[model samples]
Target: MLNGVSGAGEKPRVLTGDRPTGRLHLGHLVGSLRARVALQESHEVFVLVADVQGLTDHFERPGVLRRHIPEVMLDYLSVGLDPAKVTFVQQSGVPELAELTMYLLNLVTVSKLRQNPTVKTEVAQKGFGAAVPAGFFIYPVAQAADITAFGAQVVPVGEDQLPMLELTREVARRFNLLYGGEVLRAPQALLSASPRLPGLDGNAKMGKSLGNAAYLSDTQAELRRKIMGMFTDPAHLRASDPGRVEGNPVFTYLDAFDPDVARVQALKEHYRAGGLGDVVVKKHLLDTLEAELGPIRERRVGYAQDPQAVMKLLRDGTARGREVAAGTLTRVRAALF
Candidate 1:
C-alpha cells in the first residue's frame, strides 16, 4: 500500500488504464499491462480507455484516437487480460466521470497544476510554450475524477506519475473535508516493479511519438528488424571487445524480457569478459521476444478479425463502469447539495 486508505481484508477497488493515442507496445506490456492482468485475480479492476484524456495532446488527431480505441482494447485482450474479470470503460462513455471532473476541478488551482512535476515535464516536452491547452493543463483533476468515481483504492502508476497520484489524493482529501464526508476515497499508488523500458533507439522511455517502440502488433519481421538495430554499447566495435552491458539497450531488454535468469547472467558475464558479440545477444533477445509476442500477436489478430464483438465487450463493460460511477456521483451529490 502506497498510503493508508484501503481497508484490510477487503477486495480493493482498482483503477488503472491508458490513453488511446496509439496501439500499445512492449513498453506498455512491461510497464503496467501485465500487472493489471495479475491484479484481476483478487481485486476489482477497472481499465479506463481514456480517449478524453488522450485528447489533451492528440486533440488534433481525432481520427487517430478513434481508430486506436479498439486497437488498445485488442491489445488488452491479447495480453491475457480477461474481460470477464476486468471491467473496461471508455472514459467518455461514463458521463459521471466528466461530471466528477468538473466538480473536482474546483478543488484544484491553476498555479498548483503548474507546479505538478509530471505536468510540467510534459508541458516542456510537448513544447507548448505559452499556449498550453486548458484541457491539457487540468488533466490531473480529471484523473482524480477517474479514481474517485469508482472509489478506487489502488491506482497503478509509474514513478514519474507519482505527482499526478499525489494531486489526486489532494483533490479527494479536499472534497471530503469540504463536503463533510468520505465523498471521495483517496487512491493509493501501486508502483510497477519493472522500470521504464527504453526505446529501441536507446531513448530513456519508449513513447509513441518517438517512433522507437516495438509495438505489440509488429510483425515478426518487424520485431526482428527493430531488435537487430536496437542501440547497444557504442564503444564495443568488435565481437572480441569487452562490452559494457550497463546502459546498453540490448542487455536492458534482456533483463526485462529474457525469463531464463541463468542464461542471461552467463551471457552478461561472457559479454563483459570479451567474447560475446552484440549480434549473438540481439539474436537471443529476438528469440525471447518472439516466444512471448508471437502468441500475443496471434490473439490480437483473432480479436482484430472480429471488431464488432470487441466493441460489444467494450460497451458492456462501459455500462457496468457507469453503474459504479453513478453510485459515486449520487453520494457526491448528497455531499454537495
Candidate 2:
C-alpha cells in the first residue's frame, strides 16, 4: 500500500497509459513501464493502450496505428508486466471513458485546456498550429475521464506530464464540487524517480518522432551498433583532450545503466580530466546495456513467436477492465441522477 495517505485499508489505485503511436522505445522501459511492474505488488493498477488517444494526433495514420497494437502488447509482455496482476486494457475498448469525457468537458474551460503544457508542447512539436484537431485540443479532458472512470487515486507520470495530471485533478475537483457528489476521485501524481534517458543521438529526449530512440526489442548487434555510434563530447577531437562530462550523453547513459556507480563515477572523472576516449566509454555503455537488455530481447522474441498468446492476454485483461469501468459508470450516473 502507498504510504502517507488516508484510507489505509483501501489500496491505492493507479491509472497509467501508453499512446500506441509506435513500438515502445528504451526511454519508455527505464522511465514508467518499469515502475508499473514494481507497483503492481502494492497497488491496484490499470495499464491502458491508449489507441484512441493516439488517434487524436495521428488521425491521418490510423492504418499504421492499427498495425502496432499487437507490437505494443508484445513490448509490454516482454517487460514482465503480468496481465493477471495489472489490468491491461485498450482505450477504445472502454466506451465509458469516452462517455465520461463528454460530460467532463462541460466542466472545464477552453482557456484551461489551452494552458495545458502537454497540449501546447505537442502542438508545437507536431506543428499542428491552427490546424489542430478538435480531439487533439481536448485530450486532457479525455485523460481526466480515463483517470476518474477507474476511480484511480494515483497516476504515475514523468515530470514533463505533471501539468496534464494536474488538469485531470482539477477536472475531478470541479465535477465533484459542482455536482455535490464525491463520485469522482481526485488522482494525485506519483512522479518517476528515474532520470530521463537521452537519445542515442545525444538529443535531450528519446522519442520516435525525433528518430533518436532505441526500441526495447532491438537486437544485441543493433544495440551495440547504436551505442557505438552515439554522440559523445564533440569538442574533444582527440582522445587525450579534456572531454566535458557535464553534458556528455555517453556519461548520461552510464548514469542510467551502470550498476557500478562508483566505477562509472571514476570513469566520468577520468574522461573529464583528459584520458578516456569515446570508444572506451561507448564500449562500456554497450556492455552494460546489453547485460540489462539481452534478456528482455530474448523474452520479446519468445512472446513474438506466439502472437495469439499475447493478444489473448490483452483481450482477457480488457474484458475484466470493462466490467470494472461499467460498475464505476453505474455509480457515476446514479450520482448525477
Candidate 3:
C-alpha cells in the first residue's frame, strides 16, 4: 500500500510496534522510539499498539492491558511520532491479522518454535518451564503474520529480537515456496541505531516488571529517587577510591542521555582516576536526563488529559491499517487456492 507514497523509494516498508503492557521507559525511548521517529522521515512507517500480543502473556490480567493502551499512545505522541507520518494500528482491532496468524501456523513447526531463543529465554524468565501456554509458544507465528500481512520488508529490532525476525522470514519463505508464489514478503531486520540501556539495578535489561526502570512520565521527585539510587561501582568504598564505568548504570545513563559528549568523557576519566565521586556524577546525569524528559513529560500530561480524542486517534489509525492488511490478506488467500 505504501508502494507509491513513501519517500524511502525502493526501500522495504518499516514496521515497529510495542506491546501495551505498561508505560514506556527511557530504554524504550532511546532503543526504539527515537530511531523510529528518524526512520519515519524516509520510510513508510507502521507502529502497532500490539494488545493481542500482550494478551498472549498477560492473559491473566486483561484490565491492566486495557488501561495501558492509551498510555502507550501518549508516550508515542509525546515523543514526537507525528500521526500524519506514521500509521499507528491496534492489533486486536484487526481481525484479519489473527486469521493470517492462524494460516501461518501451518508453515511453522512446533520443534522450530521450541528452538526460538527469544521464546526459550522468555519462558525461563516467566518460570513457565514446560507449561508455557500454547498462545505464548506460537507468538512468533503471530509476529510473522503481523509482518507478512502488511507486506512489511523492514522490521526494526534489538539484537535479542533478530531470532524472532528470522522466524518471520522463514515462515514467509516456506509459505511462498510450498504454495507456489511470493504471496508473503520476507521482512529484514533493521538493527536499532541506539545501544540498549541497562536497568537502574545494572541488570542486562531495563524493564517495568523488574521495578528498576524510570518511566517516561516520571515526575522530578520520582526520577530523582531512581537516579540517586541507581547502581554504581559497588567496590568504590570511598569518594577518593577509583570507580569503574564499564558496567556502572550511572555512567551508562550518562552515555545514553547526556548531550555533552566531551563532558561525559571527561567525567568518566575523572571517575576512573579517583578524583570524582558517585554523587557528583549522578547529579550531572540527573540534570541531563531532566533536560530531555521535562518536555516529553509536559506533552504527555496534555495528551493524557484528553482521553476521548486519543481513543479516536487509535480507532482511526486501526481502521486505516485494516485497509492495507486486508488487501494483503486478499492476495494471500487468492494465492492459496
Candidate 4:
C-alpha cells in the first residue's frame, strides 16, 4: 500500500542495490533480489542502479554498464519487485551521492580501506596488487555515501558485505560526532538468510565473472544445460558408489533452490547411501529450477519488449531519489558550515 511517499507514519527506509554489470542470475535472486521483494512490502525501499561504482571495474567498458542498466531493471521487475512500492535510482543520476562521497572520503583513511576484508579479498582475486585503481580502492567510502545519503535505516546485503556496512556505520557515526549533530543516520545491515550459492563449476560463489551463473533470464534449455553440467561428488563415479553430499555443489544448490525440505533430505540420504545417479539428481534440480525460473523468464521477456517504459521508470525513480538525497545534502552542508 506504500505508494513511494513518506509521512509521519512512513515505514522505515531500506536501501539496497546492484552495480549494473550484466543480467542478474540466480545468485542475485537468492542473494538480494528475493529479499528486496519482501522488504518493499514493509519498508520504504530504494533500489539503486550503481553505475558509478560499476565504472570502477568496468571503466574501459562503459557501454557494458550502459547496456546492463535496463537489463538489471528488467530482472528486478521480473522478480516481482513492484516499482510502485520500490523506488529505483541510478547512481550517477543523483549528483548528491558523489558530493557526499567526497566529504566522506576524508573521514576514512587509506590504511583503514586497505584493511577491509572484503576489499582485500577482491583486490587479491582481481590481481590488482599494487595497481588497484584509486576509485576501486576507495569504494567503501562511496558505499557509505550511498547508504547515508538516502538516510536509509536498513540495508540488505550478503555476508560478504558485512564489512562494508560496518564501514558505513562508522562513517555515519564519525560525521555526526564531528559535525556536532545527528544529520547522517547510520544504517543497520539486514543480512540475507540464504548462504552464498555455489557456481556450476563448484566455486564457492556463483559469479558472472566466473561464467558459472544460471541467470534468471535463462531459457528452460539454458537452465537444464547448466544443471546437467553442475559439479557433483567426483568420487561417485557410478550409481553403486556412496556419494558425499557435504561439499557437492549439486546438493548444495538443491538445498538452496528446492522448497520441499523432506524431498531434498530424502534425496540427500539416497545419494549418500548409494544408487542415485548424478543425472537423476541433476534432473530433479533442473525441474526445481525450471519451475522457479520459467515464470521469471516469461516476465523478463514481457518487460524487455517495452524497453522505453523501463527507462522511464528509472528516470522517474532517480528523480525522486535526487529530491530525497538533496534534502539530506542540505542538512549535511549546514552541519559542515
Candidate 5:
C-alpha cells in the first residue's frame, strides 16, 4: 500500500477503471490489477470498463473500443477478478456519470485541468498541442464523476493516475462545500507497492500503443521471443564483458517476477562482473514470467471458450452499477434543486 492510503474497512467502496484499449499485459498486473483481487476481501470494489472514456482520444476509431471491450473483460476475468467478489461497471451503461460530469464541470476550471500533471503529460504524448479535444481536456471531471457516482472512498490506481484522483478529491470537496452538505464522497488514491513493470524494450511504461508490451495472452513461444529481444546493455557485446544491470528490462522483469531473491541477486552480480550472458539472464526471465503467466493463460482459454458467460458478468455488473449510480444521482439532484 502507498503511504497515507486508507486501511481495510468493512463495506468501504472503491472505484477504478481501464479504457477498453486492448487486452491487459503483465504491466497492468504488476502495477495495480493484481492488488484489486485482494482488495475484494476488505472493500466493495467497482471496476469500470471505461468505453466512454476511451472515446475521448480514440474518437477517430469508433468501432475500435467496441471490438476491444470483450477482450478487456476477458483479461479482467482470467486474472481472477470475480464478478461475485467485485462489481464490473460498464461506463457507457450508466447515464448518471455524464450528468455528474456536467455538474462537476462548473466546479473546476480550465486552468486547473491544464495544470494536472497526468493530463499534461498525456497531451504532449498524443501531440495534441492546440488541437486537443474539449472532451479529452476535461477528462479529470469525467474521472471525478466516475468516482463520486459510486460514492467510492478509495481508488486503486497506478502512480500516473494519482493526479487524476487528486482532481477527483478537489471536485468532491468543492461540491460538498458549496452545497453545504456531503453530497459526494472525497476519494483517495491507493497506489500499489510494486514498482511499475516496464516494457520489453525498457520503456518507462508498457502500453498497447507503444508496441513494446507483452500481453497476458501471449503464447510460450511468443513470450520467449519477446524476452529474448528485451533491452540490455549495448556496450556488453561479448559474453565475457561486464553488463549494466540498471535500466535493463530483463533484470527488471526478474526483480518483479522471480521469487528467489538470493538467486536473482546472484545473477545481477554475475552480469555486472562480466560472466552472465544476456541470453542466460533473458532465459531466466522467461522462466519466471512463464511461471506467473502460465495459469492465467489457461484460465483465459477456458473463459474464452464461453464468450457470452465472460461478457455476462460485465452486463450484470453494469445493471448493478446503474442501481448504485441511480441512488447517487437522486441525492445529487436533490442537493442541486
Candidate 6:
C-alpha cells in the first residue's frame, strides 16, 4: 500500500527483509546489512521485520519472535541504518500484504512452488520433507506480496536467493497480465558484492542453528574465545608443517575481515610454505575482526540497555510504513474493483 511515489522515478525502490530468528551475527553484517546501510543513502529503501514470514518456520515459537523484534531493530540501528533514510516496518503490521498474497496465490501453481530451489532446499534442511506446512509452502507467494506491495523495483539478495527474487518477478508479471493492468512492479535482483562468510567452525555457511556464528552482540571476551577455537587447517599439526589454505576457515575469515588483503596474502603464503602455525593465523584474524567489530559491539550494548527507545523507533517506522503501504493497497483494490 505504498503511496505517492508510484508515478515514476530515476532512483529504484528496494525492498528487503530479515526474519527475527535471533541476534544479528557477523555473517549478517558482512553480507546484507553492510549493503543495506550503504543503499539507504541512494535508494528508496523499505526494511521489513518479517515476523509474519518467521511464523512459516517457527509456528510454535511466536513468543520467541515477539521478543526478538526489538533486538532486530537495534541491530539494524547499530549497523548504521538511518531511520530517516530507510522505511522500517514489521510485515505483520501491514495487513495489506496478506490481502495481496491471497489474490496472488490463485495465480501460482502448487507445482511451481514445489519447484522453487530455495524452498526445496529449505524443506530438506528443516526435515519438513513431505510434511511441509501449507503456510511454509506458500512463502514465496507471501514474499511476492511484500515486494509488490511496496512496488519494489529492486531486491538485494545473495546469489543463493536469486530464485526467490525471480519468483517474485514472475508473480508480479503474472498478476499484471492476468488482471490486464500493471498494478505491481516487477522486481529485479541486486546481487551482493561480498562473498558469503563461512562459519567459525568452518561450515560452508554461518547460521545461528550451527552454533558457529559470531554475533554482533558478542563481548570482547566472547569474540576472543570464539576466534581462539575457530576451525583452521587440520593438516598443519606442527609449526613447521605446510598448512592448507584452500579450505581453511581462518583464511575465509581473513578474506572477509582483513582490510590489508596483501598482508593476508603474504600470511597465506607463509602458512602454505611451512613454519606458520594455525594459532598465529587465528590470532591475527582475531585482532583484525576485533578492530572491525569493536565499535558495533559498543553501540549494541548501549541500545540493549534502552529497550523502550528501540520499541519507539520501531513504532515510528511502522506508522510511516503503514501510510505508504496503505496507499498502495488502495490503488490495488481500485484496480481490481
Clash count, candidate 1? 0
- Sorting all predicted structures by lDDT, with the top scorer first, yields 1, 4, 3, 5, 6, 2
lDDT of 1 at 334: 92
Q: How close is candidate 1 to the true structure, as a TM-score?
A: 0.96
What tens digits encode model 5's per-residue C-alpha lDDT throughout 250-280?
8888888899999999999999999889998
Instruction: Give the number of the best model, judged by TM-score.
Output: 4
lDDT of 4: 0.90
Per-residue lDDT of 267 in model 5: 96
Error of 2 at 76 (Å): 1.1
Taking all chains together, each candidate's TM-score versus the true structure is 0.96, 0.95, 0.96, 0.97, 0.96, 0.96
The residue-by-residue lDDT of candidate 2 on 141-240, one tens digit each, is 9998888887788899888899989888888888778777676888889999998988888888899788888888787888888888888888999889
Q: How good is model 6 by TM-score?
A: 0.96
Instruction: Write down the lDDT that model 5 would get.
Output: 0.87
The residue-by-residue lDDT of candidate 6 on 1-337, one tens digit each, is: 2343534554568898799988889999989998998899788888999999999989998998998888889889888888778888888888888998998898889999999999999999899978999999999999988888887878999998999888888887886787666777887889998889889898998997889999887889999999999988877899999989998888988988898989999999999999998888889989998887888877778888989888887888788777777777777788778
Better of 3 and 4 by lDDT: 4
Error of 3 at 310 (Å): 1.1
lDDT of 1 by residue, 80-187 (tens): 999888989999899998898999988988899999999999999999989999999999999998888888998999999999999999998998899897778887
Instruction: Give me the runs in candidate 3 sitting further than 4 Å from their true place.
Output: 1-12
Write candidate 3's Cα lDDT for 273-299 as tens digits. 997988898899999999989999999
Better of 5 and 6 by lDDT: 5
Error of 5 at 127 (Å): 0.5
